[model samples]
Target: MVDTMKAAVFQGEGRLEFEERPIPQIERADHVIVEVGAVGICGTDLHALKVPPGTLSRIPTGVIMGHEIAGRVAEVGEDVLSVKPGDHVLVDQNAPCGMCEMCRRGRPNYCISIRNVPGFPGAPNTYGLFQDGGLAKYVRVRELNVIRIDRSVPIWQAAVAEPIGVGLHGLRKVNVRVGETAVVLGAGPIGLVVTALLKRSGVGQLIVVEPLELRRQAALACGATAVINPKEADTVERVLAETNGTGADIVAEAVGWTLDTCIQVASNGARIILYGESELDDVIPIAPTLIGIKELEIYGVFLAPFVFESARSILESGTLPLDQIVSHRLPLEKVHEGLDALRDGRALKVVIHPNEF
Candidate 1:
């Protein structure tokens, strides 16, 4: 085994430096070392790289930046028993402190100490953002954060489990039912995933709103019955027209600042889930009275709490058109290009192979 490995380190805003980092070793009895095969460049990574940074500005400089990770276990601590060396695995980026009040109440997703809280101890928080992650040849993970996958599954597909889990969490929160009209604002990666899941859940009419023609087509492939180009038409009117003037039963804001559109297109007693959050400082104007008058239920989705296993199962089922979703696959060195592609709306999901080069 080599002593040093190449890693992509965050260098403040708008910079990612390639550097040689020491190969991590198991410091704890439950620590596991993984030989990284693939990691997905997420929207959060792009947000962190923005000038002045976006919502993910809290990500410390020098941290390796990739959370959607999948690899084979290279080593396991003495106390680790669930997985062994050579096991294919996916890493759950969100490692909430299990002892927190929110976690004890069965809501680890709302754990106050999920992130590195000041003066708090043992807050694993999240991988890639708060700590060194898998945008490198190797990553050290706690056994609790590692979930073993079938060896036959491709590493690239496994790497997307995190985002898929996010979609699942949002879908669960909205309590989607069969034969309902659903409108997804934005056909980005998360929206596409949610569209696919909503289709699989038997939604009768799935409408997607996106300005980009490429993503609109991708949304159709993901089972969207109709797609609206917000740039070309009034999104709210189109959604209501698609639903025969009743509007949609469920609305998902996946474009991060389309909450207004989601609210405008939702039917009475509809459920809305906000899945995109790229900017922490962004605030949209909305009519609060409409929420109560319409009897609408609005939910803000955070990290995937308990849907990792289901996400993996969905990926393994081979039901989704994974090729349509993963638009680009680049080596670790070209992560900048991947980020650029996502930023420019030229790519959907970009997977990075850290060990390929």
Candidate 2:
């Protein structure tokens, strides 16, 4: 094995550099060293880079930034038993102390000891931010953080397991039955995954509200029965019109910029799933009176949790065209191209092959 490998290192706000880095080794009994095969560009990665300086103190400059990861096990510590070298795997984004209150309660995404963890502080303990992630030739992760995957699946599709798991987690928690209306706000990668999942679940009518023309078309291809351009039409009125004036039975808020669109389109007793993420301190307007009158049920989805297995199942089922969502592939040196494409709405999902460059 090479003593050093190349990595795309984050150089503070709006900057990323490809440089030589030492290949990580298993330093702990539960640690595993993986040869990163593919890593997907996520909105969160772009958000951190695009945020105002000093806003994301948790993500220090030079932390190799990427979360959606898939790799092959190169080495495993003596205590690692579930996986072996040469196993294909997907790295769980978060690493929680099993004894923490949140982990004990089955919600490790909110681990209370995140700040005390060795890497990044302030946010939950996650790869890319706190530790060197898969935007490199190799990544060092704990054994428990790696999930063994079917080798039959393409590495790029496996890399997206994290985001797909998030979409499945929220869908499993929501109440979307067959022959019902579902409204999805935002047509990004996650939104498209949710749309595909809803369609496979037999959603009778699926409407997507998106301002981007390409994403609106992608949503329709992903199974949305109707696509409304929020810039041209009234989103709420159009949604209500499609639902015959009542409203959608399920509304997935995949855009965290605002809650108004979801709130405005929800029907009486509808389940509104807050699936997207906002800035740590961002706030949106909400009405308590409307919540009471409409009797809306809101669900918050954080990390992938126990849904990675289900996500793999969905991917293997082949119901969703995972390939269509991945629009570009770039070497590590040109990662900025992928990031720019995602930020400018020119691509849906971009995979980075660190080994290539």
Candidate 3:
């Protein structure tokens, strides 16, 4: 095997440099080396690349940045027995310290050690964000972070499992009921994935609110019964009309900046899941009394903690419109272009093939 590999290193805010680095070897008995096949450009990556950087600015400079990853196991440590070499696997980026209070309480997503906190002394344990991730030909991951998948699953498709798992986790939190009205406040990747999962859960009317016509069409393909263009009409009015003036039973604020609209269009006792991550410094004005008066339950979703296996099963079923979700597939060298496409609102899920380049 080659000794050096080309990796996309995060130099600083708005700087992602491709440089040759030594291929990682198993330094510990629990380490596993993977030959990365595909890495999906997530919204977090864009956040990390922002001019002043978003919440992910805590990522130390020089770390490779790609979390949504899938690849073949090239080598395994002596102590790793869960997966053998040549196994197809999905990388669970959020590796929480199992000994943390939150982790012991079964909420590893909020593990204090790796959780994103301003000025927190502890470094994040997440891959791509704080460690060398799969944005290169190879990456070294702990065995605990690797989940083996069927060999028949396409690497590009497997790379999207993280987002799908995120959607699953959010949906599970809300516990969508059959024949209910659901509204997704964006048709971005997470929005679309949630929309598809909502449909599978038997929602009667799945409404998607998106300004982009292309995504609206994509939402429909993902089983959205109705779509509203917020730019053309009042989103709240349209959503209420679709629900016969009662509003949505479940609302997903997947656009980050549309929490107000999600609140405005939610029916009494509606459950709203905040799946989008906006700028950390950004805020929206909302009347707290409105939530109390409506008895709405609001939930904030973060990283996928325990839903990777479910996501793997869903992907292996080949039911979701994977093509609709994955809008672009580019090589590693064109990572900048992929980021640009996502930033320009021209793509949904962009998968980068590091080895193919």
Candidate 4:
């Protein structure tokens, strides 16, 4: 094994340089060293780079950028027994200590102790943002972050596992059922994954709302029966009319940029899932009286917990065209190109290959 490995290091805001660093040795018994094969570009990563390096800027210069990756264990320490060297796997970016209140409750995504704070004792500061990333030849995996995958799942598609897991987790908790109609707002990767899961989960009908022509078209490809361009029509009125004027049975707001989009577009008793981040932008306006009169269930899906396995099942089932959502692939040296593409909305999901680069 080489003493040094290739890593795409983020030196500072707008400064990404691919360089060589010493291969991280297993610092703990439970740690595993993985030779990273692929990592996907996520929107939040781009948002971090754009907005004046606030919380994410704490990441410091020389941090690796990608968490979504599939690789094989090159080495596992003495305490690591769940997997072996040469085993194909995808690492969970979010983690919780088994003894923490959140983990004890089976909601590991909200791991109280390690919740989003980088540089925890044995955690990777890079995987979920703080240190080095997987846009390199190797990534060090903390015991909790690693999951062995089916060797058959393509390394490229396995990158979908994490994001898809998030969608599945929300649906599992949303209390959805077959024969119900849902309106998935937002046609990004996660949005499309949610729609695909809803269809495979047997929803009666799905109407996807997106202003982007490309994303709206992709939504249909992901099994949305109808697509609505929010910019082209009155979304609320049209949705109500499409659902026999009663509105849909469920409304999953995948576009969370503003609160306005989360308005009730369902019948008297309906479930509205706030699955998108844009909802963070504006206050959701709706009559408090309506929520009371209609008996509504509104849920906020933060991330996945205890649902990676189900997500893998959905991906393995080939329920959606995972291949199409990913629009570009560039070498690690072209990290800026990938980030730029994401920033401009020119690509949806782009994979980075440090090895190939």
Candidate 5:
């Protein structure tokens, strides 16, 4: 059966329009259709519509655009047993080759075969970026992306799991411990979630560095022991002061292009987790001599792998109170304004509902 549903399609030059497209159906035994109820506007979507970096530089000008989604299962193919109709669900953004070394090492986010991720359509039909993303009335997740959430859980709060998974990966990369102090740079959704997770994981103390006032407040709400507004004082001094001049035990740098901040504030033996993807042109003056002398470890993390099971549990338990981060809710028809709001930094996690709102 064919199903055409209202969807937000990327038009061009920072614009999105509501269009009617055929709802994806199960052609493969493991495929499942999800009726999207809540989709978050991630930074990538806004960046694609505005700046268009990387493979997104030459966006084809027409496609579905979004990566954060939470919804209910519409139909499941015969081979699908993990989720059922009426099941509340969240989508894992990364797909991996289970046999790769990275996957074998429990890091599916770094799948060596990521160049040609399947199920999702994108550039070259082989390169998936702006060609087709998750912002739609319905999406055909390869069952690989589907993780069931408890029916009692609010779908909107569960939607926060994707970014939390990002934090999960970062913290795991940094090898964070119960008593370790952590400094999270950037107070956006990802940073806020990272701080929240760090607190939940029992970090001794956490300092959040953000330039925006509202974001600083959000960090406080997320359990940040200290909020650093870089403009008011030296960010490094603030973080160092909080650490008793010893510096943080771990620094999760979620703000790309701010590598200098990590270098100036980290204590000896501190592990730095680089999670942000900033502009390529942006450069930081890293003092290699100091880094080498400090015996600091640097780790890079991309997305989550095989983490959906644990991520769902955290989401279901309502640990982070994520629904409070949502700044605006608009219908699929008004996605442009939502994207614009995200680009302008006016909203924290603007979401688009399929129909009901």
Candidate 6:
């Protein structure tokens, strides 16, 4: 039986209209329909809204647009055994084609057939970017994309697993050693996660650089050894002085295009991770000579790669205060206002309840 449900659809630039759409049903044997309880407004979502029309490649207009999701299974297909109806689950946003070379190499996140596949709404990309996502009452996903979570976990906290998963992958990429000094640029949700993970891993010094006061406080609460407001103080000088002029052992850029700042405060042979979402046309000029002279090893991480489970485990351990990251709990009807809050830096993480009015 088909049913209609309210959804937040993305139009062109800066337009997110709430309208009724069909409630998704189990279409394939391995598919599951999720009754979305909490879906976070991601940095990617905010970036798309701020960019010009057509700049976000292959993302069609009017697609339901939220990927960070946590909810209960409303329906499961005949062959879906991983999760049953009424089970709480965290949705993995990556949708990789299993037949491609990258998939064969176990790098499905870099699935070669992602955009080339036909008949799928987000054929080439992951969910929500080029297809309908979880910012609605219901969303259909493959069984492989859903991970069962403990029923005791709050849905909003489960939703945060996605962003923290990104941080996990990024931190893993750099392999920050224990007792090593680290610097994190930006104090957004992702930055806070990275900071928390670094601290939990026993990093000797965790410095968070942020311009906003609220996020800086959030960073400290998340386990930052020190918070630097770049707007008020010289972040580079502060980091250099704090480390006795050596600089940080690891530097991560959670805010876009902060590579230059990372370079300034990076110690020789420091590893850098760039995981921040940036616009398609955004570019940053960097000194290649400095990178070579300092022997810096730079790494870039995309979507979460086999890190969701770890993120959930971390959340369950009660190390990271996931709820503190959310600044707004908005209904599906006011999704536009939530996005506005993100754009204006008034909110860190805004979660939408599609089932709520």
Winning candidate number (TM-score): 3
Candidate 2 per-residue lDDT over residues 78-137, each given as its tens digit: 999999999988898788888866779987776864443334353555788767888988
Number of clashes recorded per candidate:
0, 0, 0, 9, 0, 2
TM for every model, in the order presented, reads 0.95, 0.93, 0.97, 0.90, 0.90, 0.93
TM-score comparison, 3 vs 6, better candidate: 3
Off by over 4 Å in 3: 119-121
Better of 1 and 6 by lDDT: 1
TM-score of 2: 0.93
Cα lDDT tens digits for candidate 3, 108-195: 8888767877865555768888988989999999999999999888889999999999999898988888999999998999999999
Better of 1 and 4 by lDDT: 1
Q: How well does model 1 score by local distance difference test?
A: 0.88
Best by lDDT: 3
Q: Which 10 consecutive residues of model 1 have the lowest summed lDDT?
A: 115-124
Clashing pairs in model 5, backbone N/Cα/C closer than 3 A? none
Location of the lowest summed lDDT over 10 successive residues in candidate 4: 117-126
Show where candidate 5 strays beyond 4 Å.
Answer: 52-60, 97-107, 116-131
Residue-level lDDT of model 1, residues 1-357, one tens digit each, is 679988999999688999999999989999999999999988888877888777444578889889999999999999999999999999998777778788899998767656443344544457888899999999998998899998778889999999899999888987788999999998888999999999999999999999999999999999999999988999888887889999999998998888877878899999999998755556789888888889999998888999999988988888878788999999998988998899888999999999751
| Candidate 1 local lDDT, residue 126 | 78
lDDT agreement with native, every candidate: 0.88, 0.83, 0.90, 0.75, 0.76, 0.84
